[model samples]
Target: MSTATSSSDLIGLVLGTLRTERASTARFTLSAPWSLRSDGVEGLLIRVSLGEPYWIEADGAEPVLIQPGDIVLLPQGAPHIVRSARELAPLPFSGLLAQHMSGAHGDHPITFRHGGEGGHGAALTELFSLHLWMPQHRGQSLLSWLPPLIVLRAAEVATTRTLALATQALVDETLTQVPGWQLVTARMADLLLVHVLRAHLQSGAAQAQGWLAGIGDKAIGKALAQMHANPELPWSVASLSRVSHQSRSVFSERFVQRMGTTPMRYLADVRMGIASQQFEQGQADVARVAQDVGYASEKAFSRAFERWAGQTPSQYLKLRTNGAQIRRHKG
Candidate 1:
């Protein structure tokens, strides 16, 4: 909710929000002192700052030059840093000061702050982080809308302090461990995400068709929201047409043209995404998940999931479990 959430914190929060969990702002950290590091989780990141500059490092792509109000998204999760632009690495993501940079770097964390040069100056270096553990379900259905990177300038968002404050509160309560902060943080983070995304859609960037972009459009976005909000609705052309206030033929055409797929196909994709999420969340019974996603039987769902996910539900869950274990082991 608060711009106080750093790139990692925002990702974590968004992840947590989608997971329907108590965690708000997801699993990450905020910095009191300045910082430069790779994200623990590979996802979206949002960073905003003034005065002291920062640098982000990712493989292949050139180093991103960051300034205050420069909202940057390192979508690929390439290792990077946020520091003075003057002292940048001309080659790739390597920075000079990284030579001496040392601390208890064990895991990735989200961050937010106000600061002077050198470090977060006088104000206790006020910083915040949101640690969100995304459930498998949250990743696919709702996550499809996100881009690799998104930067919303403070100048553009400054007018909406209420939303900003709400987000800040989400980060603060989550980071500071205030009473009832987790519950409150989740709600505020959701609202704040809606507002920030709305602002991005209005910007008219080419990549705006991303997650937030759809939300800003009246028809397409609304339709998408409906499908995502209820992926297992057993929706058909008639139902979708009725909901969107168009005739069957017209609705069918528009949905295909706009979403680039037929309503049924779109529904199938949504189901697959939800199915993948279930796998990550640790639901092993394929039949139950299939029914939950509107499939009448396991055979039909298996056919669909195999096509959409390239693996059966059972295989996919096994892969995810193995992957999570490997991550933990590597950690």
Candidate 2:
């Protein structure tokens, strides 16, 4: 396969693993002199500006101006402030929700209207917010490799007309609340995420370093695809280099340079990631999961899992089980 196609396929595989579970969607309409602070959140947070321009300041980052048609993603759900001006005193986001939301759960998007009366020449802003829960095992790695704030500018959205159309559709679906609107909005939000990542990759931001840079590299991407596609395989530097059509030494050096880890180490991490997912999903048979991930014996797998995850298999399972029970109790 051509290098571009290989890279694209590798990206597809990586993105495919990032499945999102819908949590909540909110539509906010604010007049000028309004600001809200989110004290970090779990899972991914997405915000799309549909009306007047606004400013967002993520923790430890400079403020960013978000214009109409602009999409902002907090992949790690960092604490942030959205305001009409950077100097404005921000109110807690939870306060707004408590004041406006009626505590009714349904398919309809939660609506919040805050700010001064609209009589004066106040700037009115409308934005849609979405929260999604990503897979526990894979999401942390993927999100860690990404910048905290990913902004797809309005100009870029205009150029990629599909993104603009999808955003509009999401907004309309959330507002109208037609039959099956929940599912439609969720799917659209997911699609927008894909487009945003693609745009970010194409913008050369992925060329610097990290997993994205590894996927963008022609030779390294091929090896990564092979590993991800079959983590159970007994992969080595020599074998992976052969697949990449490069000498063993050259491929190994390039992979390490791009991915910041040795080829074998990356493969081990991939295997462990799959095994962790299995465990998180209630797989009680440790031996089965070990064998499935190419561990010759349960003891060896346990040692490696402990090294990679900082916890033994049983300990990890017990922790996960306890966490689930607590969530159930709260529910």
Candidate 3:
């Protein structure tokens, strides 16, 4: 996180960090099928089958047939479409009445279609999008080891029955649009995500590598946890080497190969990422955050912040809080 020149790299790092934090200030909602086309998706798409089976088509990858209890991951974020059991008809974003937005804006909208005989049946379709602000990882890493797409299916377990029923209640709550029901929707989205993540972990796939792989490794997991727990420790490669019981050079190489980042860069990122979280939560004072991140002077912190965040600390905070507010309003 010491330096990131690309937005995609920053997004990959931010997505990695947010995938685990329980505070989960992020949100999820049931978008009208084309609503995803209007809303910014740039991330992941999750859909629950309503009745009929559907499939996906993408380049440099095989078209996946999705069934009940199966989840698919489109790793490369290619153009994807979900069609009925009978045909491979495409559902492009243009069909949703949105213009040039396809290429003029940021990430194209990722669409999640709830298709099945159920037809939004008793359960409302849910789409969760998580975006976090953090500096990007710098180096070759495991982020590329994962498949281009991933899916988790839950139809087989008896526990899923309860999930379906609860989702039905969510459907009712959203349709009625009761006071504070958005909170209910947000909560349900969080819960549903936990359920989906659980299935992914249970599958023991390589893609679960980000969180599970990092946290599960005896050496690297311990190191990542330590970095996260005490980001302001002014950590150095030798310090981490002592903790991981490896030589300094060995530790640096292993961390880079395993985590896709150098130790100092990761430490800088964790500290600044923590600061970013505080800013998002409305902790407005940049000077105080600079202290918390262990910068003795505001000037150094500001330079680092501008380099990592592409804005001054104050500007970054304002953008986060105000930008988040704007998104909430648009929703």
Candidate 4:
């Protein structure tokens, strides 16, 4: 396969697994001198700018100015501050919600207004906040590889305009609260996420390091595509290098440089990741899974899984099963 097609296929496979379990959307209207702080969250936090410009300060990162039409993603759930100015003292986001919202449940979006009255020509800011909860086992690895803060500028998003349209649709559906708006908004959010990630990946910002960078590299991407496409294959450095059309030494070095792991280690991770997904999806036969992931014996597969996951296969299954039971019980 061509390099571009290979990379796209790998990306599609990985992204397809990021299914959100629950999602909530809200609109925030604030006047000048207002700030809100999030002490991080369990899943992803997305903020879309709709009105005046604002500032975002994520922990361990420099403050970023967000203009209207821009989107900011906290993929790693880092503690962050959103404010009219960088130095504003932020009210805790939880406290703000408690003070302004009550029994906020259901599919419709909630709108809350805060801060000083619109006097003295204070700037008013409008923002759409999206919180998505994804399965931890499926999302944790991908989220860990992404930067804590990702800002997709409006100028860049204008090239495709799909993201812009999706955001607009989300805002409209939520505000109108028409019948079936809930489903419409949810689907729109999913589309918005895919577009945001595609834009980020294509912007070269994600090329700095990690698995994302590896997928963006022409040579490395080919090898990664092969591995993801057929994890059951007994792939060696030489085989993968040939698939990538590079010398084994060069391929190995570049893989480590971009992915921070050797080829075999990355393959192991890919296999384990696939195995975890299968287990989550109700595959319980240990030996079958072992062979499916290329291991010759259940004992060898169990050993490798334990080393990678810090738990035996049965133990992992037990945890997942218990967790599902708890969720069902709560429901």
Q: Show model 1 residue runs off by greater than 4 Å.
A: 1-41, 53-71, 74-89, 94-147, 159-192, 202-213, 323-331
Which scores higher on lDDT, 1 or 3? Answer: 1
Best by lDDT: 4
- RMSD in angstroms, candidate 4? 3.5
Cα displacement (angstroms), candidate 1, residue 152, comes to: 1.6
Worst 10 residues of 3 by lDDT: 20-29
Q: For model 4, which pairs clash?
A: none
Error of 4 at 52 (Å): 0.9
Better of 1 and 2 by lDDT: 2
* Deviation from native of the Cα of residue 36 in model 3, angstroms: 11
Overall lDDT per candidate, in order of appearance: 0.51, 0.75, 0.50, 0.77
What's model 1's overall lDDT? 0.51
lDDT of 2 by residue, 1-331 (tens): 2333465566666655565544567788899879999898777777876668899999768999988877788988889999988889999997767666644332346787788786667789887778776545434355656677888876854555456546656765666666666566667666777777777777786646667788777788888888877777777899899988999999988988888778887787777777777777789899999998888899999999888877899998999899768655754
Worst 10 residues of 4 by lDDT: 99-108
1 or 2, which is superior by TM-score?
A: 2
lDDT of 4 by residue, 37-133 (tens): 9888877877776668999989857989998878888876789888998888989988767665545443346788888787767789988777776
Relative to the true structure, candidate 3 has a C-alpha RMSD (angstroms) of 8.4
Q: Which residue ranges in model 4 land beyond 4 Å of their true spot?
A: 1-4, 98-111, 119-122, 137-140, 159-162, 171-190
- lDDT measured at residue 285 in model 3 versus the true structure, 0 to 100: 82
- CA lDDT of 221 in candidate 2? 80
